[model samples]
Target: MGCCTQKCQQISTFTIAAILLGVGISMAILWNNIFINIRNKQLSVAHDTQGFKMWKETPIPMYMEFYLFNWTNANEFMNNKWPTKPNFQECGPYTYSEHHIREQLTFNENDTITYKTRKIWKFLPEKSKGKLDDKITTINTILASVADTVKDKNIIVQEGINFFIKEKSEPFILTRTAEEFLFKGYDDPFIELAHKLHIKGLDIPFDKFGWFYDRNNSVDYDGVLNMYSGVEDINKLGRMHSWNYKSQLDYYPGECGRVRGTSGELWYPPLDNEVLEVFSPDICGTVKIRKNGTILHYGIKGNKYVAAPEIFDYTEPQNQCYLPKGVHLDNGVRSVQKCKFNAPAYVSFPHFYSADPSYYAGITGMKPDPAEHHFYLALEPITGLPLKVHAALQVNILLQNVKGIDVLKNVKSTYFPMLWFKQTAELTEELSSLGKLLLIMPSAGTYTAYGMIAFGALLLTIGFYLMFKKGWKTIHDEEQLLNQQQTFN
Candidate 1:
């Protein structure tokens, strides 16, 4: 009975060891192949998922810092007694806290959601370098836009508009407070007169003139957007289906007209070393950015993408569509005239960074530095979440001699630097910790599986050793008993 019990004990030990070994291998396989994929799926922008909650209303703290170019020699230039080049003095980083919210979400059956974006901006006086009431002298946008509009009209009509401009004594250069040049907006007699006269080209939507006038806390400014919800297809998350209920825009032709790319708010996961496209409503088009390198944010690795050098390169075949007809723009500047209500407005990198040198040839005081003016985005590749963003854009206006307009007849044609702004956001400490946890959980699970496997192997080895030793002892005892019997015989 003792022998049978020992044998049964050894068998039971081997059985347990084998079971543990098999279980450890199986668990490792499941954890790596099945469970990991499921966990990633849960992170998709599906309804009721954590990603969806975050996308519905952004929790990241965002800021917009405006830097206006104070033209130092506007008077000399307007009087045609200026030097060879125009001089500009960089002014202010008027900072504002930006808040974004997606309103009126309508989830469709086709795995898409239609929504409108409402952005609210609050001025941060403490963060700003200059007060809003600080005086600034720049080009009179009203006079410039009016001259550009009627430049092609009948000669009589041109003279008639010119007569009105001269009679009103509209200054080619106007002085206003910084607030009037940005969000607060200043009233112009030309704006009222154009509206009263029902001028075709000068009929603007707003009564006041400002760079971002009537845009604060406005939902209608950024038109309706229809994007994928990522429920059925995770790769399509945040990908735009239509903007303002249209798949294409009339502002540009060919591929430039397509309403594609993400809304710069979210991106699809599992990003490889590829170009990323962001749809910017402010520019009324898509911007292509490529991976520059890698960056570490809060101890987590991220891919950094910057605007491609060919973004505004007219020589490139893809960007040829962005060039306006009959407009000979240099490689650096992109005309947003059609999108900006025919105002001859253009956009470039801050201080024309990465732009063609010709853009700043006729101007002085433009210092383009990669650290301050470049636009870049850092994203965590696994979750496709933005880790850091620096979106910088400069607004410029083209001035040229317009026929019959006395103020512009002798004006040297140049791209006038107006203002540039940098919209920035970064992952906060609390959010970074949460992101770190998400990244750590998978590795922790993998390590736990490895530990289980190792422990199971150790148990199997110990069980085999004990069984072998017990068998050897039993055999030795039998041999010794046989020897004793032989000696007694």
Candidate 2:
């Protein structure tokens, strides 16, 4: 009975150890192959998911830092010998706290959500290096835009525009405060006259002229966007379906016009792609950023994606479509004139970083620094959460001599630097702690699983050793008893 009980006890021990070992291995496999995917799905942007709430309105604090290129030598260039290079001085990083919210959400049955983005900005005087009242001298954008527009028209129209410019005595260089150059616009007589005359191809939207005039706190500025909610397909989360109900923009041709990419807010999780696309409503196009490297932020590992030189390279076959119609631009500059209502505006990296030398040939004080000018985003790979964002872009205007326009006849054709802005955001400490904890979970689970397997193996080994030793002892006892019985006989 005692032997039978001991044998049963050994069997139970082996069975329990086997079960534990099998369970540990199964858990490890499930964690890698199944549970991780399931977790990602649950975290995707669904109707009731945390991702949806976060996407509707970001919790992270965002800032817009505007750095204007103050044309320091505007007078010198205008009055000096013909073909004088314009000189610029980098001005204030006029800081503003930017708030974004997705309004008028309509969840569709096709697993998409349609909404309009409303952005409000408040100036942060403490964070700004220059005052809004600081005087800034720059090119007269109204005159330049009108000159460029009517240059191709009949000679009579060109003469009329020239006469109007002279009658108005529009200086080649206009002076305004930093505030007027930014959100608060200054009144331009040309805008008023164009509105009165109903000038063709010269329709100005607003009454005043400013870089971001009438844009602050405006809901209708950024049109409606329809994006995937990740309900049916988690990988497609936040991917834009259309902008303003159109899959393609009228601003560009071919693939450049296709409305594809995320809304620069969030992206799908488990990012395995080499490139990430972000659609900027401000630029009216998509920007593709390639993975540069990896980074560790606040103890969380993230993949860093930066705008490569090839994005703005017009010579590339794929980027040829980005070139404006009937306009040839250098490799670094992309003409957004069509999107900007024929203003001859171009977008590039700040200070023409990574741009062709020709862009800054007739301009001075342009020091392109990658550290300051590069556009980059760092995201956690698993959750697709942003760790750091530095979205920088420079706005340039094409300045060329127009026929019959006396003020611009001697002007050197140059892409004039207006201003650049850096929109930046980062995960807060509380969010960082949560992200670190979330990242630690996988390793902790893995270690726990392996530990269980090791412990189970140890138990199994001890059980086998004990059972062998007991059986051997019993066999030796029986043999000794048999030997004694034989001696007695």
Candidate 3:
């Protein structure tokens, strides 16, 4: 009876100890969680944190806004990454630069559609190479007569005109040829103006990085030239951008055609006087560095790197837009030191040249994976008025109406072809190959934190298991010792 009573007491004590251990462990884990939350909450308000670490389970596309740099004293703003860092954010020459992207749609009031067409040069869809008819004979006679007159006979540069004058459409009954016209200099008054500005003449040696463009632009990105004054003039000239007088949407290199070329102040290609005239306007983003393309930033008052917050909500039509990603006040993004509120004075090359798409940038340089959207596109800045975050921006995709007749005559009618596309997809495809500059914004409260309840339970269970095992072992050992002692006794 005495032994039974003692054994009951021991069992009762061991059970109580295990229960206490489990309870204490559970409470301690709970306290740790509370402390961590409190600490994080405090850190979030302060600006010391670097970037956002939250997992975006569902990143909804939102409309956004941005503001142009309007401050008069904005030039003093250093780190304007023009040409220095020629992604989208940093500034550079305004050519066929298609880098930078977002994930919202922006319907621009100014993005009006105008008449335009693209030219192509296919692998001679037909074997129609050299066809000479009445037009060709007349043209050759005129050329030979003209060539006999000019002192610089070799300069009778007859290219786009005679080459494309096929049998059916050859008009302009052979009144002119390469040797006839008085050859003059390329009509670029802007080059003189550029010289006036202290901005260094862009003298790139061959295709050096950052110094020159790798011939990767619209031959017309500089300007499209038209040689013939006739309607079928464009047919004679090579569109120089895409393959031919088609495929205008294909401005990017490689797929449609991304050959190599030089950037900045390209000399006239031996005047294909066939190029009756060249389409060049005062290169808008190129005056006093203002003519240079700009890297933009709507960096929030304090948060420079976090994606620009909602310029406006996506629920309704808005006046905001998504600026290009990577545009920041830090790490070298620039502002438009001068926004020419007044349009410049230049010829109307209505076909290819346009300064309209300079307003905003869609996303670029990213992959088209759904899971990779945020990683590639989340580089936004807080926008002010006149700017908004949008993926599908109603902005000019290409300066239109510049093909065919337009190219031959070199029209400049501000024909920006503002269009729309999936903003994030475009950006990811462009920037997927670029180095990223992500900012870590520590959340005051993790909006998507998982509860640590399971971890607490696990710890508590382990604590109790250890205690119970020790107690059971002690009790068994005592019983075994008593049995041996009784036998000896």
Candidate 4:
């Protein structure tokens, strides 16, 4: 009928396809942008105190964490600078309580087996209202028995004292609950805490039996059969992928005493425990231990103005985990600024196509594994610092990634700065870009869908092309073949 008819039809088809692809590409770009905008609204990396579930609940000060080096150093520092009192003369100040005195005594009794000498402590006044108490007596974990003391304060001694009086006689030793040991000794001011510890009999003093291998320091030969080796729970004890890199104590090493927070179990307190409330790492509450033995405490506690909580809670080995001082509890999360380390450099995307090496998970909780993906960054403050098995994400990434490919990307490390210094960000980041996009309600989701139209367009375009490809090809081939046949005939 018309020469232009067939050509127009083919042109129309091409135009339609082009329009569809163009629309799709545009939508994809738009959706990506819209997703970004929508995400921004929902995202929150710069911690919004308002957005988080504020902890009107005050966390109790409990057992702290420590590093071996820090433990030795702090012990040495107190031993040298503050030097132990000659006798029980001055157990020092506020830090010393009946509980601490008891811990000191228990530690002394335990040390008696090692030091070849008896340890006596004298509590003399140093600083603060508590130490200033004339009736209050202080005890030292280091000093030998101090019978002679200033008349002002009591001579509180444990010479065949009732250290275990609170415990029943039948199971005198067995009565020592984790909470009791958690206090720092047979006598932490908070000895009552032992009952609170999730894992009972844990205070049994793994070392009581002597080093498992004496030479290797590695216990539990059977642990080697598991994916993780003889190391204690990385959560409770510390990382133990290898012997050299292992921490003195790790939590949840081989799923031994491992306990993870369930869906509603994640906890984060709002007010800084230190800034607003008084705290002690030596107490049991310093860490939120899962029943599984993952000791989740703070990564940094107090600010530069104050000292960090003793991480290892070094008062007594049986009750206290010997840790390093600088390795104090990152607990009592004062500020995220103090808890997190700025990334050395940001990596470019499609992280999948990334070629840069530094872009790898280093100190950040991100494990070095390629397949594993985690939201938190774990670093030893040192390279290859081990983590409690479930202490951090197996595959850790930067805690707060401003530029990341993860769908649940959150610039705000809401969970990092809080009490559960060990779990996934207490506040889960949904599909938010910076933590603001996809939401719980339908309106937000509908808007998300509308905002998602950009991507939808692309999907539609792709679908159209895939679906119509054969039909379009058939039309072209038939037209061409018909023309060729006509010419030949």
lDDT of each candidate versus the true structure: 0.85, 0.86, 0.23, 0.23
Per-residue lDDT tens digits for candidate 2, residues 316-397, read 8989999876777778988888888788889999999999999997779999998999999999988788999999999999
Better of 1 and 3 by TM-score: 1
Using alpha carbons, what is the TM-score of model 3? Answer: 0.22
lDDT of 4 at 333: 18
User: Over 4 Å off in model 3, which ranges?
Assistant: 1-187, 194-414, 418-489
Q: 1-489 in candidate 4: lDDT tens per residue?
A: 422444455565556556655655565446555653533322211123211112111121112111000011123222324222111111112221110111111111111100011112222235222322223212221010011111113324222122333232211111222212222224332123223432222232222221111212122221221012101221111111222222221322232212221111111221122321111111211232212111222332111111112221234232133222233322211111111111111111111111223332221221233322112222111111212111221111123222211211222221210011112222222212222223223345344545445555555565467456733344567789999999999
For this target, which candidate reaches the highest TM-score against the unseen true structure? 1
Ordered by TM-score, highest first, the candidates read 1, 2, 3, 4
Sorted by lDDT, highest first, which candidate order results?
2, 1, 4, 3
Query: Using lDDT as the measure, which candidate wins?
Result: 2
Q: Which segments of candidate 2 are over 4 A away from where they belong?
A: 1-25, 77-83, 270-272, 454-489
Which residue pairs come into collision in candidate 2? none
- True-structure RMSD for candidate 3: 23.8
